[model samples]
Target: MEFNIPGIVNAAIPTRQDRNRNVMIISSNSGGSYNDSGFLSSDFPHSPAKLYITAESDSFDAQTLRDWRDEGFNVEYLPLGDGGSAYAARLESLAKSNNLGPCQSYGIIAYGDAASFCLEHFHVVDNNPEFKLGCLVAYYPARIPDPRGKFPSPVRAIVHLAAKGEDSIDVVGHSQMLGIQGSRRVSRRRLDRGVGAGRALDMAYPAYRYDAEPGFAEHDLDEYDRVSAELAWSRSLAVVRRALMGYMDADASVVDQNTDGKFVTRNLSQTMGTYTAHRSPHVTYMPTLTGAIDSQELQRFYSEYFLNKNPPSTELTLVSRTVGSDRVVDELHVSFKHTQEMPWILPGLPPTNKRVEVMVVSIVTLKAGKICHEHVYWDQASVLMQVGLLDPKMIPQKASERGVKKLPIVGREAARRVLQGFEDEEDGEADNELIPGWYDDEEEEEEKDEQEGKKENTGKKTKLQEEKGKQPEKASVGPETRDEDGQAETIPERAKSEPKEVEA
Candidate 1:
């Protein structure tokens, strides 16, 4: 009989958004698309926040906007012609838009010069309660507000600064300078109350400093750093989520369903159904660079090279599992016999019929209750050693000359040690076996002490025998003789058996 999982085999329908929170993205760039911004529309496609792009002109990359809409966001573009009264009036009108309820508020995300303007005029929202401003995020603004001044209650704010230049704000009356290498120096001034002052007062709001230049978080910019951009994205998302109360808990059951389809059930369609339908999902087996990106590629890889390629005796034991807000991390001990050709772990290698054991860590990130990406990691050297593909003793000549005899890779013992540790068993394996002369000094001292004790006991026995006038018994020699089958050799005379004395 065949059975299908509810959320795994079918995507969940989105709930209606009657009171969705609003977010305004203000860009300083005059005539560019949403792609020019540091944020990706696809990232927040299924978010419970309504996104609005306020720019100088309504002209934007049409394809980019369409992509955002396809991702399930009600995105709109509003034009802010000139600055001064007209811009403020337009913003005020948005604050009074019928889309927002009496209890709802909106957030602002500004960049460059527009960020500076928002920071300078943040008081407009603070003084007016009807503006209903929730939070403000500024990225690489030309100027920043005084660090000691705090924003009013119920309004959260954060700043992301570029590490390539100086800021207008001063710390403890000293100018704040941001170095190209992301070095920060602050001079603290002692207050009259014996209190240390500087960062403590300057931390009126959360400020993040990135080691990259301006536009590092933007995907389309030349200065974009994926690492920095990702870090910033997480922080920004956290702030927005907290302020707007827009938290989405990822469903861990979807991951379990995917795992069952891949390893146990060996069903391709069910495995593909566990991934997000809103965007392209990906999986990466970091050891062999296997797996694929997007639904089509992933389906092909799983069907041909992964799902059915495992040995029938495969076993997986979960070592540890960590459930986070949007991801799950699992440490697993996997064991299987190399009974057939397995392409995911050992590609293009014939079956050696060897039992292999290794530890694998998988990180699965989910979006909208579906898997977005998965990254699996394991020790490849240990796998190769267990499979007989790698010999530790076969090292380069240079390594031999350096007194290195064998590589430090262990076969199944690596997995055994982890399992032992997980089970809280007494450690049976010794450590640092690869280090030369690890036990040389202790073993040599033990042998030397044993030899000295034997000598002392022999001397004591000889002294006692002499003092007591007692001679030790003479050593006896046994005859070396063999009896033939059905016959016995004649015994030699007793006198002939004694040794004859010679006249030396």
Candidate 2:
């Protein structure tokens, strides 16, 4: 009696051997692709029982199966149908029938369409399952299905998925949901150029070594770049190996502590004060007391070189400061005038009378207000470039000449211009308004107004004098009364007042 999966596999049942672990290799090709199977068998570092599966095995080679068996794989060819309907059921049945322990099956290595199918349906076999998949390695999957859908099954396994190339399907963007919500430990790899899916697989599993001359894994399709394939292979292998070995990358979280800003500043000032005063004794703690440092050696480093040696003139300008609960981070702009030789600070450089300006950050950890330790950081390249020792052109660093005349406008005005998009704007009418000789002065404007007022007043006075000169002779006398017909009646007017009504 032959033990075979009905409708899935044939009746050829080989005697099984006890194995420590198993690797299930899946492919979508109906005709068993012995090339991939052979490559994987030889490339895998560990000797685990390999199971080669396919969706359609109508043209399955019996000789190939014999070859794999000879190479030592407790192999079985379980054929799955379209839509992957029998995949999950057949996988579970095979595991149960083999009497394998929960951890006996190490991982699944799927390529092409099979890779996509396995990822989508891996959950079906995982949910309410009896076994654990240690890890999953998928190469150049055809299509990622329902990435947004919940896949709580594969969370237990570490997933190492690779995208084909830049132009092709973006594996990272498409599979983002799966990586974030589906798996606990997931990593992605990008193989530049259309290196093909086989190249990525070959890189990870170097089943066969290529000769000096470039050769394609698939000889029929001349689509191989040997250099790219080799680089991608190394990266893929590293990710897969690390995942299977239960190694995880380190992570750190930084929390901003609400510290007393004034106290932190005071402590930092003291540290700089010691440097300025050239007194190592005033330091809070011995330089080499802790942190892989020798106390006596550090004391010599400070007293003999840092303090006593030719300490260059420094003008420290503070840039920013952040105070945490027990730590203080200070960023400062340090200007060093290299007038004397300081072997400790500048190492072997001879005094060149050069002034170098560089930004340095100091992180100080404190306990009970006194400084416990301080770590200072600065870019040595900037300092080197400033001192003319390093050629900025060669290093590709931008050389900025110090003491360059300040812009016509700076500070608040610069900020205002930037906010107003002045850089992109053309010179409008408003630009000329503030230019010299554009508008009149207050004194000139007042003088023009005063001259116009005086001219109008003079014209009015001249008109009044002319009108008086043209007045009648009677108006000049003022006391004489004049009658209508040019007759004088002065005597009657003085005598008096009561007069009868005159005839009409």
Candidate 3:
């Protein structure tokens, strides 16, 4: 799909190319004034195909709508007071009045924050299966701000571009997943489960509290740049255009606020400011000691521990969920387990570098093919507490209170080294304890076979007797095996049963 955006006026832009194929551009309005600098009107998309569906003046980016009429594109700017959510309904009514053909493929290019409303209510107006979607552009579309009910709309191809960010915290470990990369693409399933968009990553901004002070200006891009250039989110307009049009996935949250455990149905009118402190990937980590960890670092940790070692005898198990979508509206939850190690995190100390078995669960949400929210869980704080932080009490005040376990960056190397040393010591004593059991089983089987041969030579075999003899083994009962010559094989008493395990 080709997109040509000159600037943004409010959240809507103009598309003025009227050669052959005409694009149905719809703009939702909220009565915001359009700026001459950031508005897209005069120069529409380079393609010679465009149309505009706009709403009233004074109550929206009305000034920009006037320019569309002069540009010679088919301009049908209506007054929302004249037609509310029923605007599309009215369009349909008009189409029914006039004999219109499906020859004109349709597309939606939303400016300012009007795009969110359009996405929120797509299923309501145009429900025809024939109208899959030409393209959808939501520039600066705000997140779903409510948690009451849902307004579901899914276009085959949709793009959402936002200027702000959100924060996260829960049962997961403590760490911020920052973002400010040019842009990213996420799927719809991930919108519900939660993850990250590849583009806007490691940004410095934090989530603004729903109820911050009145003077907090949401437009502080300059201040952010001055404070830390890395934190600035003002990417080139062209880059943002690509970011918003990358995909049509629905794995993203409609609401930008906390998407869990509360009013999850509320939609916001606009974002007040940036949201920081992303949810760490440890929100759902819980399982047996032999489970798997799937992070890149965790895999490397195991390579250093078992695979690269001389004999490669250190058994490693890792449990993890593949990284995926984190959209609010539609999301996907994926989980897996294997044996591995963390060279940087120790089970009992801060992991500077060590490999150990672990489990991970990640929930990601995606919108327009980009991650909107992500939650993760792991075992870090407990390890540090076990090895000892500067002060167990101060290790991670919030994490400790919630019983979260994670290793901090400061003392990670020492803790991992200590854990590796501990592992080496434990692996050394199992030689005689585990290997002999296999040999003993073989010897016992041979003795039993000899006894069976002798019994066969002495007496006639009975069907009932044969079944009775086999029943004991089948039922896993009457344990001790002895030779027909009358001798019980010595059982190795090293180790036996293990404790039960669980996960979150």
Candidate 4:
């Protein structure tokens, strides 16, 4: 922080542009001051894009520079010892003055204090319509904090990749940055759900904790790096690069996290990357990731990121909760010491005495990486505790007189549900049912309108004719295969068939 970061940026000579567009990359993470070329050569977003990167490290005339030149981007290097602010201001002036290809872009990516280097220019980029400021991808962004407990900047349409676990601990020093309910955040690996590598990054996860059943029938996640894949180093890079590209252009869509084999229409963010367009009890709505967001929409995103608070806004409501992960072989072998939620009342087993740890770990095995065969090892009890569903003492409870202070604190909005058995237990529902991709409210409305239009086109068919009509000719339809929750999704828009009476 003592160095003139911008000053370092100022000294780098602009590379000659064969193409008009350019990407400006700044490498400065709390890990240590690195140079314009900080990430390892193999890191996904490292090269391939033609642009300039200024980092906090000592840049040597080496192969990386050669490799960058090979890719067509003009390479520039700067040392942090320069005039920080003046340097940064000058760089900003230079970037503003530079022109990219018609589709070319301007960007600044940071992992350390260097991430702050671009904050001053976010609003500036937003105003310049011609020069599309592509996505600002920040990894473990540091130093900036808001009084309301969220990221400080108004990141308009920027795709954020926040790596949890290093809240206060920087590269060398123990500087406190973000907090949780007035307390400085600390790294508790047992509680962290991080991969086996102790120093790896851990995402805060979603409202529904990921549960991977412990048998080989499920995936063996040796590295839970949060790439939506299991040990998929290459796939992780692919997705990160895709996001970086989308941030630069006007239209870019995130790959479907569930399956890379196919693509969905939705442009994705982190929360939506996993939950896009899926229908289910857990995710209530699909908020638009592309529109201009107001303060309220920003709040909803923050709440989902912070405490998982949802609703009361035009933006999609998310019942946010962390998605759990464990990639190391021995990392998750340790038992759950305590899941932090104070006794939360699960719907079915309200009055029971089953204080438990959540292990619906099946959901933990995402698709951006390899997936193990699950749907078989999912256990109800293990999942209940992980989600703070059935408290230990309340699994099968009666009116045991525990002091009010001793009881678990479930908020006032909820009136207590007395003990009851599972709602879909005997009826047969998977623990975490994969909400079908076709089940969004918006889709339903669109379907309804389409159906009404079809009815008008065909004119009125009688009740029997409509009910027992010939199969409405449609495309080659398929049956429901297993979805995320191991349940069959109700096929949307399946063509109807008629009943032909057979001779007795």
Candidate 5:
């Protein structure tokens, strides 16, 4: 929460009274060096509560600290040589210092050896009520604390364990150490019962196992797994926020406002205003590879290509939405008539005067309560098929040399199924119509039409040959003509004598 350097002059260091809480990160590098110049810059002028402590002779990734800063924390670095008794003394001095506000709380995140040290010596803060240590997060520690050991009130703890490589810990053994049967999967209930018997123990302490090697949560590491990292990040963030900030939720209004601006109001400025001012925002339409990066390009896209290009009959219905700490995901069903050239969705295509329907998914990430980036996804094949540009029946089959055949692409039925739901089988549209022999009736009708066409051509040829031998009689044209309904129709003799209308 607060710290006092014993040997250094008090006047040399400026005090940060504005920040009430602090987060101290103790890394594993034994010889890591630290610099405070970047942390004191004008970029982060808001909070001075976060600290990164490392050794004085080693080098580490600076991007890791910058990432924490991007998450709205003011980060600082401290260098301590070797890190043993001196480190413990420094932590003691910080706990005793009066610089922090009375109501403020601080948390710690430790890595590797430092994490092991924190887990072993956690009682330094857990035993003292005056120390304002709220939570502790350990990543891939060499040793774990006793599972049956209880952490007293006002001190919460969690540990992340790697599942593979040398860094992996024996989780089953640990569960057995707590007097439970050794199983491949650790039971939360049994662990809770084992640890929550005493009044001093905290029942909510969590230990998560990631199916990756150590350093999976760090962004700059070679073994970094985004899926694992994100999952762990959400969990760790939830613990820290619960301890310090009482669970602040991500706001969905920003995304809603941005959507309204783009679809309803069609205001370029209003849409752009929803993005974060702190960084350059980007948007990507994944299907057509049409999107904009930064303010100027985005404005140009909205004005010249997107906002005015949508047809008047365009309609968007929200199917579902999921909101997280810093992002929003929306599933939308969009329908429109192909009455105008839409550069965003149907680039370089003329209006086919056909109705189009498709399902779209948009993922919007936010920073500082504003949009940071957007990823829009939709099935382009279904869009093309709905507008009559793509013919599934004419598509070539790649598996065989059977020149050409049908593809599995669908038309408006895909969107219809999504909107109407798939539970009602009887009322739902037919399935697997494109599979061979699935629709035998249609195949029989095609064969019948082909036979009728060959017979008509033979009759015409025979009649021409007969006329050739005669007195050069005028050859009659086909007896059949296609009517408006696309059916064969024979012209009557009375109708042939009728006069045609002239345009003049």
Candidate 6:
């Protein structure tokens, strides 16, 4: 099984050569642009050889293709014709041709429909000695297929689905399907307010919307939700890195989110001594302590904001963590039963006692094995909405009159009930016919016109013109034009039409 896929391979930078891994990105569409920058910066801790494959080789946008190439990714633009067997064959062929091995850590990033297809046929590459995929990412698939099907794939994969809250696919069914599947690990997360698939991975895509103008479209108009997309991407990146390249524990002293719902500082002495004890600036929504909060200030913050003032139900579940050469990225699902009002987080609002769940990503930079800086990110808009501090009517947000529950869909029973409430609507128009007849009226008319055109043009070309068409037009030397900068420029035929000025 050989695929005639014309591809260009790219290697990592000299410094990251040893840590180089491989990632194959399968595009959903048939064609893409090729003119790409293909530059992977040094900030990316790992060197993963990225192979981007599109369906069509000849049909592609020059710029888009170049952009993929510029990012130092291997790109194969050959069509992966229709049929599931064909797709599986092409993937197997790609793996064999690339000579992917255990030494060359590998993973797959399947986008859109490609994700669904890959998830279904992923087992094809599983048993291959030359290609062992460590992690699999399905970026916004239409409907997460039943993972418990007869052809079980013993792989750990994450499925990200968009929450449009309209005539959308059955996310609950998808979640339950993944949850029930007997696999290594399968995590299903619903990104609320996400308008479409691939929106989480590609920030450039527009998000889903409900209303038009002054209604719910006011604050929710933007195509890309920076907070959701960034959070999702960070988590996805961490999962891939840990799955492919592996992870290590970052030595640091911090408040740990214990199973017993207690915030305990482990090894406080060593952690406090390792820090510079300088006052660190707080930029997030929490306004308790601001600007260079030292070790003492941090302890005070932990006591006042987290331990004492914080609600007893406060919980932070570790989602995914990636340990890099210079920094450690942690993704956490922070939640709390808002029983007490803490002015530190919500400046003026009182406790509504509502349960809240929000995702957070924290990047910790280390200087000589000591924590130098940390950048924590989470959607404040979402948190405000969840805690009932912010009014949804006043602002366009997910937590409105809608009955969408907070994430982590509890157990299988809850999942079944959640799935039962909704009717499985057709993904497409049920009334409209999707498949066309054997003969397309417009296409037949066009073909007739094309044949007539060819016949008409056959005799239009003169013998000399036909002969010249076979050969390249020789450049005729002529008077050139000068621009403001005195750069010689080619004079257009219209400009050349002007009568030559009398020599003066």
Native-referenced Cα lDDT, model 2:
0.39
lDDT of 1 by residue, 377-473 (tens): 9999988877778889898999999989999887777788888875666663557777889989988999999999888877454443556645454
Per-prediction tally of clashes: 0, 2, 122, 60, 4, 28
Model 5 regions more than 4 Å off: 1-80, 92-104, 123-131, 139-235, 395-405, 422-504
| Tens-digit lDDT string for candidate 3 (147-167) | 221222123223323333333
Model 5 clash pairs are 31-57, 31-58, 32-55, 32-58
Q: How far in Å is the alpha carbon of 373 misplaced in model 5? A: 1.6
The Cα RMSD of model 4 versus the native structure comes to 23.6
Regions of candidate 6 where Cα sits further than 4 Å from its true position? 1-87, 123-131, 149-154, 166-222, 248-504
User: Is candidate 4 or 6 superior in TM-score?
Assistant: 6
- Give the candidate order by descending TM-score: 1, 5, 6, 2, 4, 3
Give the higher-TM-score candidate: 2 or 5.
Answer: 5
lDDT of 5 by residue, 38-93 (tens): 22333533334444433233554575556556665555554445778777666555
Note the Cα lDDT for every prediction shown.
0.63, 0.39, 0.31, 0.31, 0.63, 0.44
In candidate 2 the C-alpha lDDT for residue 68 amounts to 34
- Candidate 3 vs candidate 5: the TM-score winner is 5
**In model 2, which regions exceed 4 Å deviation?**
1-105, 126-128, 154-247, 250-380, 386-504
Q: For model 6, how does the per-residue alpha-carbon lDDT over 1-504 read when each residue is reduced to its tens digit? A: 542222111222122121112122222232211111112233545445544333222343344344334333454454435636676666657656666532343456554556556655553223332334445555555545433332212133565554445334432122223122222323454434434433422221212322211111112234444454444444544454444434424443332322122233433354344443332423233323221255666555544554455676776657667765445777776666667766445545677776666666777654334554556675666566565445434622564345433432221122223233345433312322223443577779999999999998765755545555543244445578854322236865443342333322
Q: Which candidate number has the best TM-score? A: 1
TM-scores vs. true structure, each candidate: 0.65, 0.27, 0.24, 0.26, 0.61, 0.32
Q: Each candidate's root-mean-square deviation in Å?
A: 16.1, 26.6, 22.0, 23.6, 15.2, 33.0
> Cα deviation in Å at residue 40, candidate 2?
31
Total residue pair clashes for candidate 3 = 122
Q: Which stretches of candidate 4 lie over 4 Å from their true place?
A: 1-53, 60-86, 93-99, 123-130, 139-142, 145-244, 247-427, 430-504
lDDT of 2 by residue, 1-504 (tens): 532222122122122121211112222222322121222334345444444434332333354344334423455654545644467666546545665432244345454455566655553323224434434444345444332233332223222233322333323122223122222222343333323533322221222222212222112225444444434333433333333323222111121121221123323223233221111222222222222133444454554455444433655655567754345677666665677666544766787676665555666643323443456666565456456655433422232253223222211122233224434565211354334455668658989999999888763533333555432212222356744322234633243243333332
